[model samples]
Target: MIDPSAPLPRPRSDLTEPPDVPQVLTGALRVLQGRLLLHVSPARVGYFRPQLDAGRSGLVLCGPNALQQARKLRGAEQFGGPLLVDPAVYEVRAASGDEPFPNACEDTFAFDDPLAVSLAEQRAVGVTAPMSPTGYLHAEDSEALKAAVRQVAALDDPQVVFAAPVDVGWLREEDSVRQLIACLRLVPGPKALMLGGQMDPLARHPRSVDHLRRIVAEVPGAALLRTDLAAFGALAAGAAFTAFGAGSRLRHIVAPGEKAKTSKNFSTSPHVLFPELMHFFLGKTLADRFAGAAAPVCGCAVCEGVRALDSFASNAGDRQTRAAAHNVAVLMEWLRTLTALPSGRARQQWWHERCLAAVDRYPLLNAQLLQPNGFKVPPQLKRWALAAPADEAASARADANDYRRS
Candidate 1:
């Protein structure tokens, strides 16, 4: 339990997957091989843990509510992969108009409740590494927000990353951004997760993109708790690590207490990332999108000969797992390429060239498909292509580095 009067704790300085100095922060940029992570939904944890173990793909993460499975995750394999749980406590904050998040356990207590910390500690008992609970921003630099960051940083574990979802709109506020950065300095490291923000990650907004880059570029190593593919763009903007949900459902996140946008897409089916387009497409839509066009072929283990969907069909009953596996295999391959680059600058340039190539492919692919209005470049991809040319990223930050499929 937090004693409001107690002094703040010192955090462990080592924040890498196995703990290493942050090149992105210290300007000692290196190709990050050991610094890798994958975020998966609680349901897909079983599938990703083995993949991470076999490929040694680094850490895996899930939400605070995933603690209930601690019993099942006991022993050598218990609690899964060199892992960390996101204490998404911000959902407990009250918001007007929006419906409450259905899965939040923190709604039972006040955001300032010391009882909240004890509850989180109890839940974190068997996990690989404990994270202190944090909540969403009710307002910029809200005292309650500051208190929550302090509370999480004060947790017994020194490896804790100060993870929180600030409304992306507030990022445009200079003072609030400064204050937020100061608050983040209190933790072992800063890692920004944009959920329930006023702007979409790919809206191509200049100010929000620059501000988001500032927040993430501060401590690039602690990016393991992300839920969207846009987080991949941060690497181009100078982040040290990357992780996203294993499926579409897990990749996009809404703010706490805010009503999540409902999609007609099936939650159980994997949303395959079309590497050339840098967009997630449902199976049938993907097949239809490239119907007559020469579709991209994935040579990943799950999709060796034919198209990914065809490969998934032949696999039969386990389509979800197969598609999900293929998506990850494709992503890991991309990471492997980026990691093998000699230095950070080389990776950024290579990534920019890759995004530029993908953005170029959209026009030809759309033309080939005979679509009346050709597909538009995903704004994040468009922005990233222009944003990631080494020194230029800081002046106009953008982050659209989705993994490739071909």
Candidate 2:
């Protein structure tokens, strides 16, 4: 059972079985990994009860509003794991459609005063240090953010420093990765990287993988938290751990100018994202496309009885729930595969071969994967790419045969 009072897990050199961090703010925690970290919000406190009942090992991420509520919960003392408070100051400034904070433009929550003191009180009650909601606007901004984190760390003496890098689209540039690494180095302890804003483009870009690989090479102990599901591959590149939110609408990071809105239209649809193909299709569309083919669209429980497009579109709430569950399950499976590999290079090779095999099974996806500047196999995967198509097919067949025999 997870003891709520226990210290947060520290980073280790060997990431063979990297810890699982699930953004359980919106959805349930299904992957049962010992010593997990759950991201929760006060508004969604009800959703976390089930996890507590299961006695899972992990900490709760208490959003600013949720902090008071967490302290008052019935079994708050019995719950295992420390509470990590998220000031969520960025949400106040974000265009999330919420009522703006009073004197919103003029008032700033400076770390040197209010934050430092509040964080100290929070730590007294088993809460981890509050993460600075910093953004990476320019070189100067990065330096300032690092200095602020360093100052706050000195005051709180936190086990880990949590910070966000806004405008992650800049990750495409190698210089941006280097600068980010430098900023992380300035922090006093293990760091968690939160990529603010919509990260779909960066997560899908092939070069972004190389950039992440470089980060792992430079800062092997950093954690990549609350990122897009597509970027889960970074675990193979050498990140200590990666996470995705369970909510269908929850994004890894919140950026300025990003707006939030609620709608009753909950029509849910499952879309399989082919990273190599750089494309996704609705469950129904994929089903139709493979009407007579032998390729598998998805093997999740929800996709089992789904025969037609209308079937998935019929129940919005149920479909959305299942889709969220499936996404987490898929990411967990991928992590398992990478963990079993002996080294980062081996994991990268395995990922490359798997992507190629996926392309071979779904020939219709060939066009997108073969386009100019589209899904170029990384240089490290060149050896595998050298094999003829026939050899690749034979190797895959042999592997299947070996598995069946075993």
Candidate 3:
């Protein structure tokens, strides 16, 4: 499990910009292609770590506040894949002086340079980017933000990627996002990690979807973190690499001061991922559906013949954890299917067909269940079916070069 209270180490001198990125990190990205990674949280580590050792990849994303957890990764040499200690320095109300370090797990992060803390912590944890820490970029403070990014990208270490956690405004405003991309381009790196903040789990917004396509087009070695099922679309859109959060909290990064709604009754129920529909449904809901006469059976590894996903209905924490493990497996299985194709266009085309089939089933499932209001198609599912993949030859090349696992 991720130790949320992990602290960063003091500044060190070894990372004057390493000349080469280790093969391990590079290999993970190369192998990702149309496959996906997981942005894992603490409770689910037990479920995810085994998969990582068995050839799956995952990322342990932390913010300034998550340094305690970040610091601890030092002793764990091989953590499945890249472990990012994100200095989520961008603020929704920076002008108002409310929580300057929005990524803080607690209030431990001092006003001192969070980028520096991340650099030191990453070094301690064995991440190579001593010179280039992913910097915070705010348009209002263009010169300062760019300078910070330039400082990190200056050495252009092979392992140092230019990572940017986007603000919600950029997603809502297309021009702003374009401007953000232009800035990102200025301080170029071999790779760039794009972390989405305050967006839908599946990124239903057309503008947001358009922005992701553009980012993949414009940014070098573009990657995605904390994008939930949107990772599927990003991979389809040709992002070098992408991730889905293990649970709802990491699905859409909440703003510093935002208040998220909660439901105690269903709070502990696992939000099961139904691979066929490419939608998440409450455990109890799926259990109830399975109880019906004409309910569908999941054929994924998690629910192969003789075992039904209906076992996930209980509100028990352990049951929820088990259900979540199944969720990861279900999605991973779908991605495996997508990546099994020989080319990018083939995978994208296959993804679209699956999405269309998923969209068509929502109504069928509703009718079968005999409920007036049954499964409603997620706006993201609809969007996925309607959107075309990056089919141009140039796009295929870009995706191939950018998503190289090795």
lDDT of each: 0.54, 0.45, 0.56
Model 3 lDDT at residue 384: 75
lDDT tens readout by residue for model 1, 215-277 = 555533445345554555565445655557675535544565566554455453456767667
Measured by lDDT, the strongest candidate is 3
Off by over 4 Å in 1: 1-34, 53-65, 74-80, 92-126, 139-141, 153-157, 173-175, 189-194, 202-204, 220-224, 236-240, 263-269, 309-316, 372-374, 390-406
TM-score (all chains, Cα) for each model:
0.74, 0.60, 0.75
For model 3, how does the per-residue alpha-carbon lDDT over 55-108 read when each residue is reduced to its tens digit?
445555543334455445545534445555544443232311232223333444
Q: Which ten residues in a row have the lowest lDDT in candidate 1?
A: 94-103
Model 3 Cα shift for residue 342 (angstroms): 3.5
Instruction: Report lDDT (Cα) of residue 79, candidate 2.
Output: 50
Q: Write the per-residue lDDT of candidate 2 for residues 1-406, one digit (tens) a residue.
A: 1122322223435444433222222111122222224455566544433433233223345355455654554245455444455555555453111211111323435333544444554555545334544333322244344455555456544354455544555465655565666555455544566555443434434465555545544563455655543334455555544444434333455554666443233333554433333234454544444444444445533355342332343335565445434444454545555666764457656766665565454444435334333233333233223322334547988999999999
Task: Please identify model 2 stretches exceeding 4 Å from their true place.
Answer: 1-64, 68-85, 94-112, 121-130, 135-140, 156-158, 199-206, 260-311, 314-317, 359-362, 365-406
lDDT of 3 at 221: 56
lDDT of 3: 0.56
TM-score of model 1 relative to the true fold?
Answer: 0.74
lDDT of 2 at 34: 20
What is the descending lDDT order? 3, 1, 2
lDDT of 1 at 219: 39
